[model samples]
Target: MDDRSEGVIEPLPIRRLQESLINRIAAGEIIHRPASALKELLENCLDAGATSIRVTVKDGGLKLLQIQDNGCGIRRADLPILAERFTTSKLSTFSDLTRITTYGFRGEALASMSHVAHLSVVTKTKTETCAWKAHYLDGVLVAPKPGQTVEPKPCAGNDGTTIIIEDLFYNTPTRLSALRSPSEEYARILDVITKYAVHNPKVAFAGSPLPDLSTSSSSETSHAIRLLYGHSIAKDLLHSTFSSKKQDEAMEEESEVDDRESWKAEAHFTNANYQSKKMIFLLFINHRLVESSRMKRALEAVYSGVLPKGASPFIYLSLQINPRDVDVNVHPTKKEVHFLNEDGITDQISDTLQQALASQSHSRVFEYQTLLTGGIAEPEQSISKKRKGKERARDGDEDEDMENAETKTAASPPLKKTASQYKVRTSLQDRTLESMFPVINPTQIEGSSSGKGKPADISKSREIKESECYLTSVKTLRQNAIKGKHKQLTEILEKHTFVGIVDLNKCLSLIQHSTKLYLVNHGALAEELFYQLGLRQFGCFSRMKLQPPPPLRTLIEIAVELEETTAESGLTKPQIVDRIVETLVARREMLSEYFSFNITPTGLLESLPLLLRDYTPNLDKLPGLLMRLGPQVDWNSEKECFETFLRELAYFYVPGPLCSANPETEDQEAQDKAEKWQIQHVVFPALRRYVVAPKTLLDRDVVQIASLPDLYKVFERC
Candidate 1:
């Protein structure tokens, strides 16, 4: 070598790192500390389908960390290469990487730990007569003591696996030095366990500090959140489930979509009522605890409009995406992750939380105070100070001391304020869509016609059959509705103050919620509302009994005449009628029992399912519904049959567009007004009661027309 000490650059001889050194470096990347190692072990336990897990730690797991799980155990034959790198049962070929479902696939977790610490495993498969215990070091099996055989030894154990790690980072002093203190490490380990417990609430988790850390198996996610986060958060929690519309369409079309782009998410977040100094966010992508600052920041911004400045909300979100769209191999620890459509997904979730918060904010609690007698009241200066203190709180300087100061001020002479000063009243005439495009007032037409009986009787009639409630296909459809609900529109419909009909011809109406106005397409929303209701009340329908059963053949003939008048079909009129009559007569029992469509044995139409009260399916369209029930419904498959049948029923129930008949004509005017009244009183109320407003209706059915705040800004500029 040249004289390198003389300030002249010189190259040193190249040499490969020792195999042990190489392994130690790689191990450092995987197992940063005790917490990282515990995460890997926990994932392995969950992957094995363990329902109960017990974790033990000593000296914050630097000295010892043990995890025992009652899951499928490794076979004795596979013990020889248990710690070998690149050996795994989860994956086989390179292509398998695209669809890895299990927690461990690289086969490096155990090997990495072996290089940095003492690793031992005691595993017993159900078929095995005895358990096998093995010790590993540097990715190879090793003897327990000097002169002993370097092979696994049969031992007494339970029917699961138990892994023990000792002296973590023993061979890597640099990695060991980078670790936190024992107490801090223990806290980190506890946090990891806590989040995993929340995600997999059905799995029992038992960890040390027994009284402080233990969770029993639970089925309800809300119940689990209550147990872990406390009563405050749980009480204020709002739940929502959502998925890609592509997935919904795929189920209907029975066609494959790009799997890499499909995803679903479930979120439990605190409403405006619950607030904290810092956000407590737990995100699980594909059930693996991961972090995304972009998502966390986006969610935080959503709460800014609802919560006072400097306050945060608690959120727990679990996301499931196609494995092909995710690159879990990007990081050794797998804590930080990225996925396709992240921005879109984040925006959707944020919008959902924003609406939930907005709706909750509408219900305000009023505080009443009595002033002193004889005109004695709080000093003006005191009132001024109190107002300034609230201003600070609103400005984000909310602290305990300030709260205490405010409390102290409250003890002084109380201030008496009028309820009008506190009430949030809107001058409707000043800025309302109804004022611009006026039609019959929604409130004036309320109870204009004797609609169907009370909702209580309707609910009683819609009793679900216990047998049908548990059907897999029906549950999936119901879940799709829940997962596809659009939160903002749902809030609008649920709490909106009905404005008035905007255009009877277009079938559009206006409704106000808080300070914003929305134009709702009553026709489209009613169709979607009925569709969701069909799925929601599957196998349980209240019948709308016809006075006398009409002959099926007669209705079919009527439908044939109508079809011939409307447009040409693939089949002739007579052929279409025969097909529809034969199909209905074949499935009469199914129709009568599940859908409440009681058909007589003589092939005559009878009662129909009462989907919505106070609203009737126009008999004009009944023939069409009856005619298409044969060709449109997929009678071959149970799921498809129910889906297509419900769709046809929903379409039939949606009223036709408003009549172009002259408004001056008495009969036509009465019909148009009756339809408008039904929209406001029957359709909208039913929507508030049952419809979750799925994403399909977001822009198409409901559109925001004007906002009160925006109007004020415009006025100010003028």
Candidate 2:
């Protein structure tokens, strides 16, 4: 007590209680949560150039925390000052903070964390043959059990640093109660990893709610996340390059990175899309993981126009900069910082993104969907028929959710059935490498009927003209059939000799042809061949135009439709009077885009547009050309469909520049001559524009045939 109480006031001696109280308050600021402490310790390990990092947590970090890194370790001589306040090997003075390069420089994380928790460090540097270890409490070395040395002891360890924190805020009830459940905390931990993982793809980062996966209980397997979740997590990163650059703004003394910045980072978030719904994108301006609501909002905004509505994305951005511009003193925990030029950076990021998307001219996210009809290689007709029947029965011929559909049961029960009744679901050809990728869904196909026509038999389904296709397999198939006493496999093959088919519902029967498989569809199959064009790639569909005397690409699309789809069924006949009206009505816009199109209208296609009417040529063909609405796209409420109709089919088909294999060179030539083919013919005029409450995404079938392996077995072993 240095206080003197006489006539004048005198200074009092500093009380020990006051010093202890101040230390505890400071502890609250630095070690806000288990994650905060973990982050700080992790950064220190990384700054040491550690190749591997391991983290373990318990009871949402109320019980224990541990982190080990294979980086430079503290020396035994430094152990006494290891947990002391204001002691660090990073920066020595105030000016050093400006050009700071390492992750930690304030020298407060260790001291502050030590004040509220039991802390320990087991470390070994390359200089000493032996390792060193220490323990601390209230930022000071503690005597082990009352009589042990407070200094480090020689111990065995690798060249690394290991930190442990236990009973965080043991004396603070409010802080302990404020922590979330173990599972919830783990989610937050994974969330943090996801952001960092996206940014630091080369750094292998792994963490588990349990200490180790091998030691996890069987019950824990029930909660085992998808492989995508773990990969997207910052656990097993390798090397990755990012073309991210920062721009400075002299105005307002602010600098920002706009979306215009070109970036091609192969991140875990992109791969994680296959496993998890929440996809993440990371940006590292430098090394610090700063929070930029602008970056986050930009990501969400870009995704808003692309992904299904109502879905959000996850991201973590790390910006490395000299510490001077960053005010690390802003937050007690220091998990966040105030950057000097946040606004400037946001603008650059957003601008870069806008340019990137605009440059991708043909994104192909939307296309027609329909199964092609084709003969499969070595068709096991009886067995395949049986399996198909079982598949239909199990699915109940209705749309279902894909998520709830895939179960993770280790083994499925066996079914009891006679051998004669069994069948294999997939063919040997289907197990090929190319088949491993999922097949795109085909669009609905419309038959040549203005009204909903009745189901037809083999003969009626063959609605084509003899002049169009002399190669109808149906006309020549019966002769190849063999008459045998037993059910002959040859007989079945002879009946359906085409290689593959893309039907209305988008089904495919791929055929084996040497190492490569051929998908023989009646339409578009001939047009899908690879042809090199400028930077834009043009497949099967021809991109060139022909007018003076000969036409090439249009004839190919026309010929293939008759050859594949209706080898048994004939092609639709052209309509007469009404057809002329369609072509004559519209001609202007088609000339500018220089694209080809055809229409098979059902009603008065001729009345709708003169340009379309001209293509039909026959009175009956007019009805066939009238638009018909089949199933909606069900993904975008058919917006793309409507856009396609307006942009491509509104005008009559005028052959544009015949798309040569060289599209880049041909594009220039074709554009100059585009005026020659404008409004020549309507490509697919029968697609109706109006709809009543088009199907929402929820209304979609969401069918994932491969998702139900067990259920598929019923069909496989029919």
Candidate 3:
């Protein structure tokens, strides 16, 4: 052929396609596979106000798919044209589309099914005495058998409707071939039903071929989630509900009519504790399941800050907007939809859910634990080397250091602390405070001259001696604490999320419990913890031996010198010193036997009782503690003496103000950081596990700062 002949193409005359072929092509656009057909039928059942739905599938719905619902049945006259396109009871005029709320408005579901598959319907209204059954092929009623009349036949049935589709995609072989295996198709069917079940928890649903796919009516969203998903996902789930409403610019113009721009959203999402490799997202607009890649990406971005890398969260979000504001006819299968204020709505929802997840104690605790455990364990030498490198990088900029630390934590997997790991154990057998917050490097230690002493051997393997005496006085003190414990405060401490220190000089820290934020005076809380430990341990206190024990008289002299500057007393400093030394020495045997306060025969203060593991009391406060024991105690009464003495010891062990008040120098800043690390890691974690916060702490130590609901109300008014 010549080049001119090849380039000269003739246009064919246009002609209308055959009606049968035209209907078949339109049907293929709506019903792509077995799952698509099932989706349409399920929606039709729901639109009819069906509360209970039962489904049966064969060969993944390729061979047969049946659905029975106890809904308002069809009329006898409507059966003739029920499978015809555009014959729907849901709409009448063009304006009806604006306010359409029903799932099926196009009325193409049954008609589409008829063109590609064998379709039939069985129905009976409440007013009718019996049910009627009809069969259809290619959008028209057909005879059930050869030479039979082409009309509905009366049958026995309940007051409902049943739809059955046979040999789906039999005529459209290409669509059928594009589908997955039977098991895979079945899995997709189950997934669709599960999401609908969670959204419409009040409606009952049953799927045959497996018992696990059934859900009962009158259930809650949380229960449905727990039933369909595993308990692991349910336990770590977070829920949030948000809405948007435009306020009238003029009060005089405001009417009683509802706002057309208003929209509401409800969501159930997993927290940081629950993570998977792939995201499980279910989005429904106006109760119709749909997909929006923009919305999905927005949600995934919200969890990125909380969950580790390569992990995602499970989210179920349902949005209800004014029908006039949403365009439901954007997709042939109604799977993808568009609405007004789509970007604004997505942002509002993402923010609300992000706030909810951030407030979860589980997520906060998980992050805290990750930082403490360094995510996964490693050799001691390796950890030290890595920490050294980080220290150099974190030297001058405190905020940058925190940012880097959080980035590392966000990249690491969550560590689970189960119930078995927190079982109450003997002090000697328990994990030490130092393990959670390791001691600072030698350079930092050398920079501080205040409160300096040899840190205790806090290793888990360290051996120490403890008192074994069990006395009645100690038992009474323990019983009093148990009787006076506060129920609400106990729960709060047990599940609190540790926020960082608010005022390091005041020993004040922030913590979140449930949706409430609280300011905790950890210094005061620590005193209670140590006091309780002393009571419980009674004679079981671990001993902290003092090297080259100081003489009792010498300790008294130091106390006298410190007291001279602040005390206004009748007795002189020398007189006060002599009295305290004599009183303590006289009661040496009693102190050693029950309180683990060892005093040598030569009037030397040998050792002190260790109340908390790996926690050493400030040696600087020892003189003040010894001085207080003499004057504060009623030595004559057995109960009074033990109570006052233990109180003094607990007071001494409570951490004092940070040494570097200004933090102007490098050494001072390092000291502040080290102090903060110990309080956040060692002290707060111990309180979470062991202490039972009493009601007294509410007024004196734990102060409620804010609550989630209250904050929302304030913002709404603004």
Looking at model 2, which ten-residue stretch has the lowest summed lDDT?
526-535
**lDDT against the true structure, each candidate:** 0.75, 0.44, 0.77
Task: Write one digit per residue (lDDT tens) for candidate 3, span 1-718.
Answer: 7656779866789999998998899998899888889999899888887777878899999999998887788999899999998899999998998899999999898999999999999998867999999999999999999999989999987667999999999988888898999989988888888888898886778766544576655579998997788555787888887778534657426754356778988898998788889999999999999999999999999988888899999999999999998888889999987888899889999988988987775443442111110111122344345544544454447645655676455568864221211222224333433445554554333213245633322223233332354567766777778887887788878777676687777778877665566777899799988887787678767799999998888876877786533232335788778878888988899899878899887888889998866565568778777877876565756776787788889888887641335657765667566666566556676677678666666644676766543453356457
Candidate 2 has a TM-score of 0.45
Better of 1 and 2 by TM-score: 1
Better model by lDDT: candidate 1 vs candidate 2: 1
Segments of candidate 3 deviating more than 4 angstroms: 1-4, 246-258, 361-718
Off by over 4 Å in 1: 1-7, 246-258, 363-718
Q: What's the C-alpha lDDT at position 254 in model 2? A: 69
Candidate 1: global Cα-lDDT? 0.75
Per-residue lDDT value at 2 in model 3? 65
Q: Put down candidate 2 lDDT per residue, 287-314, tens digits, no spaces.
A: 6665555667865676565446565444
Q: What shift in Å separates residue 654 of candidate 1 from its native position after superposition?
A: 53
- Name the candidate, 1 or 3, with the larger TM-score value: 3
The TM-score values for the models, in the order shown, are 0.50, 0.45, 0.51
**Residue 538 local lDDT, model 2:** 10
Q: State candidate 3's TM-score.
A: 0.51
